[model samples]
Target: MHIPARPRQAPIVAGGLPADELAERLRQRLDLPTWPLPLHLLPPGTALVGGAVRDGLLGRLALQPDLDLVVPTGAIHLCRRLATSLGGSCVVLDRTHDIARLVLRGWTIDLARQDGAGLEDDLRRRDYTANAIALPLGGPARLVDPTGGLDDLRTARLVAVSEANLQADPLRLLRGVRLSWELGLELEVTSGEWIRRHAASLVQVAGERVLTELEKLAAVPEGHGGLIWSLEQGLLSGWGADPSASGRLRSFTPEQATACGLAPLERAWALPLARLAALLPAEALARLHSSRQLQLRSDRLRRWWERLEGRPDLEHLPESRRLELQQELEADLPALLLPLLPAAARGYLTRWRRQDDPLFHPMPPLNGDQLQRELGLAPGRQLGDLLHHLTRERAFGRIPEADPAGRAVAIDTARAWLGRRRD
Candidate 1:
């Protein structure tokens, strides 16, 4: 296992921008592994464009530094070199058009060549004027704002380059609102009008892509505001969400989000699914058919829907039945349902309101082996059935918590059920 000695390279130092404070600050903001002069990093004639430039101008702090660069030619291989130079990874996102990405130190540099003849022509085909921005490199680099993106950036307004251009991708209508939410920009009157006009075209786009974009807007608590706007403007109607779902989500303001529940939603793994289930009514949510994308099982959703039915007066239910709901909250509570948890169904919501660590519910103290050991059984379907029965009984509060001795009651109940099964 002889390995070749590694070579050490020079420290990365980025080239200077015009002696402007803002420009230098943006250069430093680049998520580069090291600040080596980028003059010799990529091939000649590469330029920075799109969100990295837009966000830099707006002085927004980038959590995950991403820079979109367009080259004159041979971008895929060039990006591979750039990725290696930074001791990172590269992936060819699109082979036909030669789009590639270099991922380094939480920074993603997407490299592609100018799609059309020149950069200005390329900028013309972009969706929004605020995103149709560029900054040329390796020369007298200056801000190129052909679509008046600099002006839009200055005023904190979003403007589509053209109606036809925006219509090319109806997703842009939603993305406009996302950028608005992201950078705190207001969608321009004309751009908002254009979204309302062509929002229906989103149906023609791919569902998976729509889901992808929705995930971006749902990744953070602030994203709820964008989702609400999209639903209000009919931007999400094309994706099969009920337009009325907007009003429901609009009520989930920062205050309500904090009050009702937040830890589960804010740090959700399937954020889009959490957002959808939190915003939509029980019946409206069933229509999404999103289990595959959300990685949620169909039967679990059915059980959730069933619970909403007979949304009875929990205050008036029999003592045992009220306790059943409380224990049910401890068994497999999905994060999405946290916001809609009524004040009465279970005290689990109360725990969340008080900022508890286990926001949804707590795990049981036992496992299959423990149950089997307690009942004097080996591995088999009958043992599993008994274990599941005991677990369900525990969920219903037939077995008291706060006492390991109480588990024997559940074990006895399971053995009696097995005796009946034998008969």
Candidate 2:
């Protein structure tokens, strides 16, 4: 764990601090690792580089557990060996690209051989000033910043590493916005112009990759504002339209959208069935990627909408009337509909509300079973017809007995009357 001395020069340009002065202050405050540089893996004349030192130079503690180290040679093998020594796993994510990830103690360390044959060349190829700086790993870890990342940090500006840097990966356009929003930093004018110019190119990237970035963006606290900006820049519309033409897709105001969007609304519903129905249209609902709970909610909403729409008489009704009709219809209409329902519907709902009726009231006193038992009628359309007649009669106070015998008598009398009709 022998540490190296801090470098004399800082890499950042902000805070009006000179390189050497910043370096000294960084060394005192940063919690840098004391691991020695593995110079044995370096090529001839290649000096060691540091990531911790750069973090320290920025006047912040290097609390990051894993280190990102760059060497002029043998990065692949070095990563493998480091993983083995540390009792972790080493993976060559892209051999052609010379990129590898080493996992040690639940931390992932990225190792890359300096491209362009040196550390400076490698730093020149990064995407941002903040990420372009490195630190030499030694007793105190020296900062090796080719880009003024610390200066950019202080100014709260996001600057590209170089003009040609973004061409390396078009996805960097999206990354720029995401990072800017996440860090609460304004994008440099040039970088923002480039992003706006190439906004449509985001479509060329894979869907999953694009979604991954979007998910991250959506999770940011001020993500809604950023997303709105992205939309204005045409980043989202280029992704393609939603599969269903439900027209649910629309721009979100900064205040309307937030990181809260990360939680699927269906998952948060206590009465998912009702909440889902209340929130989304049927076609839009079908297109949602949701759990079983949400699906049930969608179904319930659909049914409720159907019941409410079908019963025009219930509209503009009082709460009591709406509730009564809802009970009569055997449908679950939202309580909010009470005020919107018609006067008659409202009166019915009011009457029901005054009584101790359950949200889902029980069926009337008699059903088909009582008919079959008392009248010896077979199960057929007649039973249904008779029940309808009895229901109508009961609604008007024609039938008042709660006993099954009273209901049977009513059913027999209705059947006799209907039997007398020739038509």
Candidate 3:
């Protein structure tokens, strides 16, 4: 049996505001007056719950906030009705649990039947105190705080609703770590302990579910720190996170990528790829059932990073080696540059951004068929080798464009090379 910690002092009033004031703030932040889903259309017992209320209270609500509603019953049916009435689509999330989602005009509204006996029971069964709060969406939005979720929010702490609740879904164990870093909150001592205790159980979760959480964590600004903490607590050990890799992940930060001259859109994906590559190898991602493209990206980044580790100066590498690196990582060069010195990384990025840069986007000066017709070369290993040689020369600016004069230059170069091989 697990027992919650008693407050050191008398219980503080929830949210430091009266119910009406809190309700007003939530209503204003969530833009309730302009809601696409008319409140009157909802069931009488429906109450807004989960992240919508949480982010609204924090004043971090997005322009198009996702709404999570708890209903007394018939949530799926209500979702179908909403989809039909609003000219939208309905996706059944869980048929057995009576959970469904309605997507209308860029808004996602999830409706779920209240678990246990009532709304309060459903809130209490949630994983974290900060997420367990609710607000009745019917007449006069009264704040509901059955688990001191507001108080936890006030203190900027993440506390589990209960050990049993976390055990009910072991993914919550990892979710605690992600939420702590993503929301800039500290983990309460007891909740931290509970998460650490059940760290190993996270592997029991579905691979896709685990990958989703990891991707979310990796996308945040403080994701590297969160990953390190997860590693220290042994939460990621089962999924192929090595303690030795922590040093690499620690330096994978948005500021670092920015210093390397990665633009906002580039950093959005590059930083996450760098962080994931730092922490997990390609095989680990494969085990997580990640996409083949993602696995290839990670593998290329990791292999190149390792290759560069032995040769600190990129310019010092042989021309062919440097060309090979550029050829393999043309699209993802920014991700590979995360760990390099800022000056060097900036130089590389400037060239990489130029789509027509021959070295960055390497292409052979002449196709194999063209080479065969021009040089009377048969289709064999020698032909392939000659084509590779031409691409290298083109990438290095030694070969001209494939025009009549340039073809004459290429044929001359090819004949000279063939004569040398014969010698």
Candidate 4:
């Protein structure tokens, strides 16, 4: 029942361009045969904000697609309706937030209701001015800039929507930093002050939410420095991180750290995994407490961190043992290791690159079952002890194969060691 704002004067027709031109252009460019159904069935006043506006404005500025869309009302219902109309699927993400998402022609569009606030109210409530702008759903596609968001976008400045904006949602403090990096915009003084004042409240927000924003910033090709800027502003400390440790970690250039952090083997074979772990601290892994798999990954990373400092006696280890050590080392202290790897370790990694897969190559050949069957051992703690011994042997390249014959010898050695200990 919402009524869209009508242009005050006759649709501005300059250079043969009018208000509906962009919508018409979008309709024409949409090759999907079923687009007409929603175009015809959709009720009026439902605007696609977010990515659609982002891309449209970027297009006006000759930028590429980072498409996102926001539908002001009936967002979830409209997503379902659009999906059915287009023969696609509607994914209801958050019923509470009234958000739904869809993928059309490989472009991601997020749908959300404008609530009852109307455009001006909604813009005022948002985190930043650049994101406060909206483009109309149809016709000349005139932009709705109730908060002068367009001016801030043009100026490449990060300005909060209002003074109360960050206070309303403390997470907005981190979001401001994220948007500044993502859009390559510099934060205005007031916005920076707002973030500094309210940064401590970020801990109250969910860790997953904070981590998501951090991940997005990390994904930016040139946003590392911006992330460093956030850390320098006490944002990480405010979120419960040990500020001194984080500061010390952030002092090195990301490039300098990347050199030591990425194993030569990972550089050649598992570049993506190496790059991913290189930017993060193991501490972030603790934030994902809900995931058992992540916890295990974090534990493995912690063990690796222990190895890098040469805590356990691993000096006399063989190449395979060295490789396993390196894997664990990279996992635990990726952020710390980035700037501290020795030249010898870097060179050794190059010679050990796995051929088939980068992230994980292949499973080890031996296990407890094989050892128990081969060595006539019961399936108990003895079998576990034997497996550990065999793993160490495999790590040192002593176990030639993972077959029954090799497993039998490994178990025999373990039993002898146990017998000697019993004496």
Using TM-score as the measure, the top candidate is: 3
Error of 3 at 292 (Å): 0.7
> What's the TM-score of every candidate structure?
0.75, 0.53, 0.91, 0.69
Better of 1 and 2 by lDDT: 1
Better of 2 and 3 by lDDT: 3
> What does each candidate score in C-alpha RMSD?
8.1, 12.4, 5.7, 8.1
Instruction: Summarize candidate 4's per-residue lDDT along 266-358 as a digit string, tens digits.
Output: 333222222223334455547533255544554564355445555323345565555565555434333323434446435433434443222
Error of 4 at 334 (Å): 7.1
lDDT of 3: 0.83
lDDT of 1: 0.62
lDDT of each: 0.62, 0.55, 0.83, 0.55
Clashes of 2: 32
Q: Model 1: per-residue lDDT, tens digit, 1-423?
A: 011111122111123224354444555555444533255777776778887776666655355546788888888988888777768888999999899988877767788878889888788889988788777776653566678876666676888999998888877877787777766678889888998888778777666566566656765446778888778777766455656555545544545445444454343433344456544434433444344423343234334534554553234446444444444543334342434544432344455354322223323335678766776778889876665566556655666665557666766786797889989
lDDT of 2 by residue, 1-423 (tens): 011122234434366766566655564554334433244543443332343543444433234434566666677787888777768788896687676777766666667777886677787788888777665444343456678777787887889886567866767777788778766668999988888887777777665566556545545545545555676787655554222212111222222222212123311221222322333344433343334544454455455545555454554555555445545444333222321334443444444443434333433446788778866878988777676656555554566556676566676666674576425
- Best model number under lDDT: 3
Give the TM-score (vs. native) of candidate 3.
Answer: 0.91
Instruction: Count clashing pairs, candidate 3.
Output: 0
TM-score of 4: 0.69
Query: Which segments of candidate 2 are over 4 A away from where they belong?
Result: 1-15, 24-30, 34-66, 139-142, 241-423
